[model samples]
Target chain A: MSHDKPAWYERARKGPFVGNSFDARARQAIEKRIAGKGDPRRRKSAAVATWLVGAAAVLLAVFIVVRLQDAVPSAPSGNHPVVGAGTEGSGKNEGISAAVVRAEGTAETGKLQVVPLNGEKQETLGAASCMGKETDMQFQGSYRVVYTRGKESGVVIDELPEMTFIQPSADIVQMTKLAFADADVFLLVPQYADCHGLNFYAYAVDKNGGEAFPLSFRMADGTESNASYYPPGELPAVRDGQLVLPSGEGPGGETANGPQDRIFDLNLSEKALVQSPAAMAGDVTGDSGKKALTRSFVFSGQTYTIPYPGDYAEYFVHAAEANLFQIKAGTKKKLTSFQEDEKGIHYVKDGRTFTAVPSIF
Target chain B: MEHEFLKHMTTMDDASLRDIMAQYGSDIWNYAYFLTKNRELADDVTQDVFIKAYYRIETFRGQSSLKTWLLTITRNTAFRYRRSTFFRKVNLFASITSIQSGRSAETEYMEDRYVDDIWDVIMKLPDQYREVLVLDIRYELSTEEMAKLLNIATGTVKSRLHRAREKVEQNLKEVRS
Candidate 1:
């Protein structure tokens, strides 16, 4: 060693005493302490005395937190005004929102094609031919898609495949990319082709401009079915870093009382797709209490009025089942059911303990 | 020493608490200060460890020395302080400002004209390795004692300490050059 160990070790050992020392303060505090002169009644009185002070401190903390939260608002609640879902017959110059659809077998022309979203037979998207099978495809903003096919890779820009050829291998394609904002999230879909028809893969991109890794999903149904997705501006807006993707349609097709579409909130940072209790029915107006009801809840200082679909009682049951929201009364408990009257929705956990909803959702 | 601490704490008297604080307070503060590299945090952690030790003394099964037990509390408290929302937000703001200013610790260290002692280089090591090195050098703790404190295998502590020393030495050589 260049320098002797003992000299530097001695120096480093004294590093804590360089500027500040806690001994005097500690010695003073410890010396002034009167050891356990046991009095339960006095202890109880002391507790009561401190309780008010603690409560005031807590209230002050809460007030500051609320004020700070209000200063920086969460995503605007209510209807997510979509920029546009997709524009049909619009020129390439016009902003065309693109989404990748898995082609079963091949098209009528005996090649993979991108048809209009309206189920109308239109011109295929890219002019470039696919060398092999493409799967786990997703739309990048403005008619561009980052996709992988067999071992070949390409970025489809302006309806043209910028293709790169690579030797096909039996190994499953485990990596796919979702480009949102400036950067991309490298997702590990793992055998994406075989499970294309099974589960909907929603990619929540981190917009803060770094390559985010790991993709997760919340599968509502156990069985496999045809899966579809909506790219960025198509569905409910990404609120407070939470992107709600309508994963799949209900088993019941097109009825007033039919099962509503299951929606999952994709939080990329947490690497979790939380199944939300809210179903995807059309635009839910606040006054329209038939399909969904708008119940306003104050979080921090900001008031968020989201459309609550289904019975208020059923909503709590589902919410508890999903573990999406938790309520704290005396003790923290997942709510079971709720009732609404003159005050607000009263959420019940055990038969006895009932607190209002939106206290801490 | 461990038995003596246990006997004193069993009394739950003023003198017992004072004795524990007098004996272990400086060591705990040094450990915390080295790990956090912040005097304020080290002071807070030292106080917190003593308070926690007072409440949770009954649970201290006497398997480890009182010093190790207290140091364990100090480490946990230090980490908890780091993870708090206020600390995280402050750190995030500092990071953003530092990023904007184009001033990183790496750049600052590389720019340092004078080669200081090994402590400077030791502070530059990653959190895990740096912590192990601090405990090893500052306290001269055995591998078993470290594993008990850190809740890791003794092998991990040994390897991390070795790696931390190597990195510190390498950085020191670089600075000297």
Candidate 2:
């Protein structure tokens, strides 16, 4: 082994620029901490005492809450109506039919509440065990697929009145909802292995309570490819009902014209992925063709772009300022603060408040 | 200079904290990123690490270098993030592109394909192996220092380093073949 470090290692040592926004945010947090409770360095003993008291208070609160919950009469099994389930007047819940809500307890012990968007009707849809706090739900027609990310991540598929949880392979990290065929919902599962890179797998879940199975793809040479492994960052694109993946080297040695894309039509009925014609790849609209919904506004000579119809806790990035502001329901705050009250959305800059209008791009 | 910095760390004010962040922020951020493989989590971990360092500055015994101490905190903080169920929502594959930034255009263009491939292999290693390899190769930490930072024995560190290098070599061979 060489004692001297490689040139690449030296280059890697410099690391990525964390950006000025991060520094600003860190400084802001420190300032906030200092302003709130005085300098952290000066309050070591006080901080410890405060932490102990806080912990005790939290324990007492939890005990009282648990006792109070036990004192209340339990609702009969099945559809348990939740309090404050209706969002009739809430403008945000306009078209959403139903939503998966975290129940009263912690994630490990709680049950997910499937509450109607505009009605008081709610159903207790299984335990929240193995479900991550951060969940991505996709509404496909009437089928609702909730993909959770965590240590023991799994998917919750709700076909209206009935719901089922499917635990994917331990290696699978992400699950993207793909086009469905009949009663089967197809999901693109990306599994990562050490040194082996990421491999894309197709999973078909039957809404009629049938077990979910991995779908194998028929390669161009009539061989079945269980999964196509691609290097990190080279994810396969799903378009129309076909999966367009970059092809590896074939039996005929290296291709003089670079790697071609192998498109596979999802045949859920056959329970297998069949190879489609190469021209089909060109027929579907690529990712670049689809426009992302974004909203932008200028504040203090810097333009900030955020995702449109922004969700709670979504970050708004100001490139020039290198600052990130988190969006709440009606207000954007953190780092550089932007508040939206009854009057209008206000942007505070250098002891001055300016009203700003929101526009979509 | 490090001793002076450590001495001042105990009495670190807002300006001192800002100065410390400026000096060691990228290093902490990069280490956190390397461990967690998520940029957003890395940002959070970096901020948390500095805040933690500021709050717990009196505990700095000066046994390790200031950078190592910061990195040790960074590793622990990153591990805490990894263990947290909330922060585990990050897509690992998508985060691979994050490490490619902060390089000069000339440096990027002049980089050899072999070098890029090697780094790619290094990045894709399992967390345990990658941590050891990065500490050894990138941070240039001694085995003893790495063991201390990782909370493992020196022998274990050496073994993991061997396995990490072996895995990298194996992956590189596969890539080349």
Candidate 3:
């Protein structure tokens, strides 16, 4: 990704625009005033009046915000009321409760292996520092070895500072701790065998011991076939689930679509593979769990592995929107390495390699 | 209150529209400047982007990043300026009244010696390559993002970027020689 050019990203950190602050001010001012000013229809005209100033400012500004709007608000969030949809569903408890709830299966979490993306995978000290600080460090069982860094308020999977998260396997065998921290959250990612294409599906075997119906991608080609994945089921691949496109409004307000969506939430029980990056900071760990412990180990001059659950699940590192990489657990996080994203600054560590950490499942 | 929402203060109540300005006004302005090399023209393009962003906010599905969406609108607006009679009128106006002022700005800028050599190389590139070069370099968007922003294919983005980079590299070598 390097070249003679400034990498198309330096444009953002360039000189700030002359009129940015004022435009932001004007924007906030107008949006606030229009909050209940009748139809909010007339706001457009007033917006036109203040357009020039904001326009001038943005050309030189870097102060930015990326808060998601309350479109179809589930509950009264951060501030604004539910927007686009969720009018009737507003008062009721929604989200996780509404999505399909799966039974708790104590499947023996399998072993984990990490493979280098390419070339000779090297290790460094920061990764070592990350593991040294992990709590309840054990050497075995249902734990994960992640590639992270020391504490410095990290970013989540889809949130800012997107870090790469790759599932470790026998082919991808390697090791490193994501970062050192009191265990906090887990981030879910779609498992990919290669860069070809990715999707998750499931099928069944009938009395004839043959592959029955399957849920595959709705590709343009007339014929359909299972290309990569299989989910857990024997019913129509899709039905009640809503296809929530990028437009925010879900088809029938049911499903969700995002590149960084959690695979765990789809059908896994309370332990959905796709977690929202949780935290143990000031939070309760419930009375029914094993000693609040995380397994730990080392590799290639770097300490790696944290045994959390008796499952073969571990947080991987990656950058989402900002194109910056870091480690995330549940809802909590630890900053790891980063490379230059389009934004201000990013770091590079071995160009997309998937390293290993010990797994206890 | 590290970053309070700004749309509240303005008549621009469209959340997506304000998000557009907040997210990518800088990018649009830079793109406009890359095209016209004129601050005023860039300003015009920026204004058009938000206005359009405001009107079409509803059409925005979360499919693309906000930055990509804004750039698409800005590109269209800048192209519109090139086609409109308003451009001719404004250019003629500046030519008639600000000829002396234009010369003055040029002299002052030259004294600073900020040669836009890169943009010049970009300007010399074929339009297909030039567009990708400017968007990729100026906006820093990924190849995939640039394709989505321009409503083109990723392969197109890669192809144009390759040709554009070669052109720039050739230009740089020539300059060095």
Top candidate, metric TM-score: 1
Cα error, candidate 2, residue B132 (Å): 0.7
Name model 3 segments beyond 4 Å from true: A1-361, B1-11, B14-23, B85-116
Q: Estimate each model's TM-score.
A: 0.37, 0.35, 0.32
What would the DockQ be for model 3? 0.04
lDDT of 1 at A306: 36
List TM-score (chain A only) for every prediction: 0.25, 0.28, 0.16
Give Cα distance to truth, residue A208, candidate 2, Å.
Answer: 45
DockQ for each numbered candidate: 0.08, 0.04, 0.04
lDDT of each: 0.44, 0.49, 0.35
TM-score, candidate 3, first chain? 0.16
Alpha-carbon deviation at B28 in model 3, angstroms: 1.3
For model 1, how does the per-residue alpha-carbon lDDT over B1-177 read when each residue is reduced to its tens digit? 544557233225556667788788778877886667765566567767777677545435455577877787787687656533232332312222210134378754553322336666777676668888788777777766775466443544555676677787677678879
- Of the candidates shown, which would achieve the greatest DockQ relative to the real structure? 1
- Report how far residue A171 has shifted in candidate 1, in Å: 15
lDDT of 2 by residue, A217-282 (tens): 554322343344443345666667566665433333234544556666665545667665244343
